[model samples]
Target: MIPNVIRRVEFQYCKLHFLLRTRPLSHVMYSGSTGLVTPVADPSLLDCSRAAAQDVDGFAIISNFVSSEEEEQLMVDIRRTLRGRKYLYDHWDGAIEGYSETEKSNWSESNTPVIQRLKAVAAAAVTDKVVVPLEQVHVLDLAEDGHIKPHVDSVKFCGEVICGISLLSDSVMQLQHEEYPDRWIHALLSRFSLYIMRGVIRYKYTHAIPTNENSVFKGERITKQRRVSVISRTQPVHS
Candidate 1:
């Protein structure tokens, strides 16, 4: 049993695992095992659980979010567009986090072709009136052993949803509920795949990429390839 101060409850068994949390706590729940279900007794947990279960009505998955060929071209274009730009910060080797404020100041008025194309792609995804155009976006590149610490995006962003498109390689993205820290949901992000996370899944859970030098999925430790991610969100962005 693992209890999280932030409203996560976790139960783990030899072949199963369970996670639970609330909205104020981060709306994601991850389950790894098959049986032995338990009811959430905490009032805060119950509130979040209810919200998460209810929020699934609008969930969407856009597989083949980007094509490998398009991703390759985009990488080249972004690199060229970003050349000599001072706002690009190295969050990790081969990974840069773009600042929206800075980007707006430096590139928004440029009318660059690549930027225009990107905007078009973003526009297509914002079909719902409630889903506004993402004001901020970030790009991440990961090589072998590269990873991010488990964390939830800051709530101040008012970001009700997060959309991520994979550009290269295939990797696993893990989401864990603070309630059930030991249990997790692993999503394989294939090149060109698009994943949209919202509702409880977006706000209530912590997400991360493990830093194992050689990660074993299923039974093999395949070398990691250079991978890029385009993260789109509505913001008041925060670190």
Candidate 2:
């Protein structure tokens, strides 16, 4: 299988890695302009609700989740939080080397006031579900051409519902499951938007942001840009 996407690398930093589409050596290589060949997805697995898009199992994509002014404030808070931290260039792929993965952090959630507002929004989104205590906060600073490979968060480090707020750019989030790994639902995540993936959507399917993916928002097709994603997960409260 081959994907026909081309990436124009805007920035390449130390230890920063990019995912290039490739098949195992077992498959013969013959390159041409073939279309994206993916299996037909099960309709039951996808929920494309655009207006504050959400699914029954708790996956959500809320446009304008926060206002521009609020976004600016959040960014300021984030910059402050990241100002004195040291980031390692090595990508953790559950291995030593050769694999480049997303740059991540678990320390930002506890120090920011903006996180409190995001917590409230999550509570309101899933009214039936109560917001639990904040677990580890995962932050990713991706350059214009940066993106994530498809994978799920380890339950050991997180809990049921996961919420993330996008800042500074718009991108498409691709979701898929083990049963239909080849198929995906490309959802648009606008800047200042909040998206939650939970329940079956969280466990059954893996989510990713592709480097070259384009999203249509306000009827305009826009390319992916630099992004700062602030992610939080819920922790099971033990009494």
Candidate 3:
């Protein structure tokens, strides 16, 4: 019993260390009962998995999940793989243009370490018992003028959790509730940051990156640039 207790404590401590790399500038949530928006003071996981009344439920982010050196190396791998590839301008919303995307069923030998690192951090950050990365890794490159419009992932495509690593540049992603438009939050994704969306936020909120204007977070304007994201989603569970 004593040895089991010790192992549990160690696990929690390691999970905390992986999550609290940087504080979020702005991560507010809507209070359904009071009909007011409240700030999620800290999103760090303290005890085992569940914490009491800590509002920011489905969305979480670690500002710096990977080191600068690792980020550069990922970029190197991306460029090598996507050399001379043509960007697509086809989308139903017509929200994105001059963007290139590819799905990697498996990572190369050089990228396996980083991929494993992402999986490890993702498992530690969320409350879910099982977090399985999908077979394909979604690699998306947005040109200087490209941005993602507000949209939700198809239920058939992926499961409850979506984890992504921001590479090359910093940007802002806004989440607005589908029913209550006023209820929203802005997540500032810094370079090399990792953002995870699950449960309610994944199904209900529509996320988008604005291109026409500067993004505001904590009263600071964020300008977008050429950005690349290495994203992985869990396999969709059939209901």
Candidate 4:
């Protein structure tokens, strides 16, 4: 009869060999010290269909939120407003890089209509409770090479709902689960699109805008350009 230790080792070796043959080398992790081969859990392992089927709560994107003409006009307004302003590379919060940000409590005559429309869209997206847009809106200008790192918004600043309208250029936003790195999804923020994040998406996922080098969506490469976003937040209602 075969010794128990030998039998166990033989079984493990067969299992390892089977896994190495069936799976891609990129999916396997080898430990040099223990001579063990383990399968790595990566988001890429799951196909796009399966990942899209996951019940992601409180995340929605509205494509073509504004007309082409309206988008052009809005871009002009943004450029004029931010012209000649010095951008901050080192922010106190350390949330952004190569970015220029300012707060807009009031919109100009040409820009007020867009702000009102954004508020309306935001109000309709979140149905649980009424979300009042704060007087101050966040205007961010991302440089051509800039990117936002993965991070969750501070609870002290905003409430449950966060609304943002992407303008000027197209890009992809990646939201990864805070607890499980392998669970992630990418949302394409096309020009003039509005994205809403609330509840689980707002609190549980760390959202980021990767650089052009690593930007991808649904297996297609994405080339990022200078983008601008007008972000609005609801008042903080602490329980």
**Whole-model lDDT per candidate:** 0.45, 0.52, 0.66, 0.69
lDDT of 3 at 45: 19
Q: Give the Cα error of residue 190 in candidate 3, in Å.
A: 0.2
The all-Cα superposition gives candidate 2 an RMSD in Å to the true structure of 17.1
TM-score of 2: 0.60
Q: Candidate 4 overall Cα lDDT vs. reference?
A: 0.69
- Candidate 4 wrong stretches, greater than 4 Å: 1-54
* Residue-by-residue lDDT tens digits, candidate 4, 130-232: 7677788888999878889889999888887788888888888888878866677678887776677877778888888889998888888878898889998
Q: For model 1, how does the per-residue alpha-carbon lDDT over 64-169 read when each residue is reduced to its tens digit?
A: 5444555666677556655564443345333223321122312322223323323333333323333443554566555544666667777775466666666767
- List model 3 lDDT by residue over 1-239, tens digit each: 54553454355436443433333212532222232323445443111112212324567665566667778878888888889998776775576676898887565555665575555444543443565667778898988788788889887878777878988888888877788755676778777767777777788888888773756665677787889999878778787
Clashing pairs in 2: none
Residue pairs with colliding backbones in model 4 are none
* Candidate 2, 134-156: lDDT as tens digits: 64466677667666777887777
Model 1's number of clashes is 13
For candidate 2, what is the total of clashing residue pairs? 0
Candidate number with the higher lDDT (2 or 4): 4
Model 1 vs. true fold: TM:
0.55
Candidate achieving the largest lDDT: 4
